[model samples]
Target: MKKIFFTLLFFGCCFLISAQTEPKVGDELIIEAQDGPTYHHIKFPKLNILVKRGKVANYKSVHGNVVIIDDVITDKDNNTYVVLKKKDGSKFFGYLTKVKANYEKSIASGEMVVKS
Candidate 1:
C-alpha cells in the first residue's frame, strides 16, 4: 500500500511539471527572420530600415514567426486586429487585421508551433 501511494504521488508531480512547461498560442517565443532586405522592406512597407534576424520589430510583416494571442477582434468601424506579443516583452497593438486567415496560414506553415 505504501509503495503504491508513493508511485502515484511521484507520477502526479511529474504530470504537473510537464503541463506547466507546455507552450501555448499566447506564449511569447523567439522567431528568427527568414527574409532578406527586399523582403523585409516590401513586407513592412512602413518601416524604412532593414530588419535584421533575431531583432524584434514593431510590425508583423517583418517576421514569419509570431504568436497570435487570441481570436479576431472587431472595432466599431469593422476594422479587425490580432494580438501579438514578442519574446522581447514588446507587444504589437492592432497587429494584423485578417486574424483568421493569418492564424491558419501560420499554423499550416508551422511558423506557430504550440508545443504539447
Candidate 2:
C-alpha cells in the first residue's frame, strides 16, 4: 500500500509540473486584475523611474492592458526570458523581460489571460 501511495504521489507531482503553461512569442494576452499588493512575480522597473516617467507601474494600473509576447530569449545559463510589449505598437511603460518561471506563474494565477 505504501508503495502504491508513493507511486501515485510521484506521478501527481509530475503532472502538476507538466501542466504549467508556457508562453510563446506573438501570443495575445490581457492583464487581469490581481488582489492585494502583490504583482505575483511580475516585476517592473524601479518605482522611482516610474514616477520620473509619469507612469504608475502597479498591477492595478496595468490591468486590462493588452500584452503581446514580443520575444522568447534563452540565456547562456539556460534561463529563459520573455519580452512583453503593448498591443498599440509602443513599448510598455518599461522594458519587462519576465523570467520563464515568473511568466508561467502569472499565467497560472490568471494575472495574464490569453485572449481567445
Candidate 3:
C-alpha cells in the first residue's frame, strides 16, 4: 500500500511539472528555417524592407526569441508575429501567415504555433 501511494505521488508530481512547463502563447522559442540557415523573413507594418527572424539578428538561442500574441488584432486574418531581440537591443518582427505555403509548412511541422 505504501509503495503504491509513493508511485502515485511520483507520477502526479511529474504530470504537474510537465503541464506547467508546456509552452503557451507569448512564449519564446528557438527555430531554424527550413530552406537554409537563414531565418524567416516578414514585412511588418511601417517597415520598408523585410525583416528576418532567427540567427541573422544574432538571436540564435531560445532566450533571444520571443513569441508574439495577436490579441490586439481581433480580425480573422490568421496572422501572428514572432519577435527576436538581438544582443545589441535591436528587435525584429516576423509574421506567421497561413496564406503562405512556406509558413504553412513550418506551422504544420510544429515549428510555430498560435499557442503551444
Q: Could you say which candidate leads in lDDT?
A: 2
**RMSD value for candidate 2:** 5.2
Question: Best to worst by TM-score, what's the order?
Answer: 2, 3, 1
Steric overlap count per candidate: 0, 0, 0
TM-score of 1: 0.31
Give the poorly placed runs of model 1, Cα more than 4 Å off: 1-71, 74-81, 91-101
lDDT by residue (45-108, candidate 1, tens digit) is 2333323333344444435444445445456965433445544344333342322323334444
Winner on TM-score between 1 and 2 is 2
Off by over 4 Å in 2: 1-20, 74-80, 94-101
- lDDT tens readout by residue for model 2, 30-99: 8788786656555656567777788775545567988787787666975555677778765456554342
Model 3 clash count equals 0
Window of ten residues with lowest summed lDDT in model 3: 96-105
Estimate candidate 1's alpha-carbon lDDT, on a 0 to 1 scale: 0.44
RMSD of 1: 10.6
Candidate 2 lands at a TM-score of 0.59
Model 3 stretches with alpha carbons more than 4 Å out? 28-65, 69-116
